[model samples]
Target: MSQRKMLQLSAGVLLFLLPWFGGLVSGELSYNFSQCLDFFYKETPPKGFHAAGYQSICQRYKNQYRFASLYHRQHRAPLYSAYRLSPTDGKRPRTSWMYEPQLVFSHASPEMEPFHIPVDQNVIDSQAVLLDYKNSNYTKGHLNPSMHQGTEEDREATFTLTNIIPQRAGSNSGPWNRLENEVLRKFKAFCNGSMYVITGAMPYTSGARWINNRVSVPEYIWSAYCCPSYSTSLPKSVKSFFPSYAAVGRNDRDSGEEIVPVNVRMKASMRGYDVRRMSVETLEGILKQRLAVTISLFQGECQ
Candidate 1:
């Protein structure tokens, strides 16, 4: 059947009656990241901020665990996504965007499903929907980008809205995108084994921005990796990046320079959205100060 025809199907055929899981309360969604533990370093997730309004999701696609995301129920955005870095294999998948049904219905399908017309009201109220981004200034930025994954299925799995946030075009395609490529280069050159990565969004301290009054726009885009196993034969310049290194990019032009500075001299499209590269420890310090929480992104700082 054609795409248009499939979407034209009666709502009766699509609407589902989900079973309520007992013992689960309202404004509460917490599941152990048990299913997707392999994506994290040492099979351990980022520590420090697991309070109310935050839910854990094991991003399952095609009945296989791909990555994990810490989604914020109130913000309708993800706090971060943890995944194992994979080499790119083919063209980007033109798959339709998806949402996490488990956020709305406890016993719904574990996999991410594409949005259909007349979207379920509960799903929209629970999480971000396609309409939230329609004609909006912000872009549906993936915390776990497709280029970072190796297999086709792995790439497709990154399209879920649970793994995305509202990002500006300058930061998403410019400096931040460059930072991702840089990490890929370092991974292909120095890493001998696995490389685990955790990428997250850092919200503003005050005057938080929202898209369509639905999704929260992040102030800074931060990412870190832990590749404990690597080739000992490394260059002096690139030695500091081993095991663990981190970076934070400016998502707003007028944001403070404390976390990331704005480059006023660059072209209009790329200026003001600069990316600051630093050691994992430095990144953690900034995270602590800004978030007002003592958080560790890697195990023992990837020692």
Candidate 2:
């Protein structure tokens, strides 16, 4: 069926169920949205969401570092998939899977910590849905690559469709790829448990501008994640894993590659705050403060 027809049919089906399920508030109705549209549509909602103050924590933990520039929406169910971040914006959208989460270091220019965001399982096993990585000319750019999520479970979660985005193949594979690997090495040495990660892409000019809109390419990719708690001091080998926050020529414009082109800038803005190292308790406190701040910023009434 056509896109319009599918949308209309889905809408009609949803409309009929809305009132009976007590509008969007009902769990069943919410589940439908999660299964149909959410990037992270798992078999169940994430346990993280129910974790005490998770929503609040995410809202208040104002991050100085972000793993990527695009964060779309959280999965409605835990069993569905992980949240997704996308660099591109269009009505004709190409979204990544929740299953393919990649650990990305935002703000590579000032390089910081690595964040791990998992994707949904449904995004992988279910071939019924269209995945952003399947047909688009873009690479399967992971927000939290498997190499960094740590555990095998975490690594597997990276395959979900929601964690992907349209990325220039060269940028995705070269410097950007190295940065992610380096972060994983750090975690193995110093991290304790549950290191929160946030990643996304940043548009040089914000709003809904497409790749076709601007003649300029992405001058830089920003990534940062904090190791809230560490079990021990990281060794020199661990530190060695960290790449220079900036890459001079990861994108070679001379190649005239078929994929989207990322610009090669000798220098980039290294504007960002420090990736503060602290005890888990202290990190929790900081996260609470930031989450509160974010909630207030977003007009969230729940405190």
Candidate 3:
């Protein structure tokens, strides 16, 4: 063969192989939640939250601990993410959203590096590449919200999509945000010890719903906290919140009002997404009914 012809052929072959080789190097083949329990408190993670084919994720960022999540592959979103609430830190870390590398890359061994992987050319095609919440009506709502963290790094770790779900603007900015703040206040004022929290979603009963066919849109968002110890002298207003409390917030306006009743008197913007706080048992009852499984958020019901 002529030298020029050989060079051209070699170039063409390199071009053809780039995409495949790049994918392999990027760790696209091995993205499941096999090591999700590492983030759980005492390594004793919650039970009965896993559905058939569920994936667990221990959210890490730059080797900094963040939170843990249980992902539903079929729904293409997180069922829940658990984290211990750290005392409030005033500094908010700059938003640099990331994805879980272990979810997409086989070479990206669990706990080998920071849990959050940067977006690059290699992982552009993986299913673990989550949808960007740009130009969309829905917000990229966090299950482990940043407000509950104590340090800038811990707050920033909550930005990863593995710890987020598609939530309504009303719920994310209004009642749900209020609920998170309230919980933070209680944790700071009353709890003298670590407070374990698990926040998750409840999909529609009949079928799954997706946002832009890329992410699951939950029917409702629920959260529960277990504080084994707290101030003995509690204010009457928040007396019932100590030890444990749970709440379920509506995500859709058209859904029935059985689990979370909508208040007709509230303004239109906040009317449909009311968050109803209840005891841990009540939340479990609702979860059992919706998820069709025995749901236990805390061991011994936080004792």
Best by TM-score: 1
TM-score of model number 1: 0.89
For each candidate, the alpha-carbon lDDT, in order, equals: 0.80, 0.31, 0.70
Candidates, ranked, lDDT? 1, 3, 2
**TM-scores for all candidates?**
0.89, 0.38, 0.81
Worst 10 residues of 2 by lDDT: 52-61
Tens digit per residue, CA lDDT, model 2, 169-257 = 65676556666555555555565643333443322223222232211122223343444345545566454222111111222233332
Q: Which ten residues in a row are the worst by lDDT in model 3? A: 12-21
- Residues 51-102 of candidate 1: C-alpha lDDT, one tens digit per residue: 4335668888888889988777667888789999988988789898888888
Best by lDDT: 1
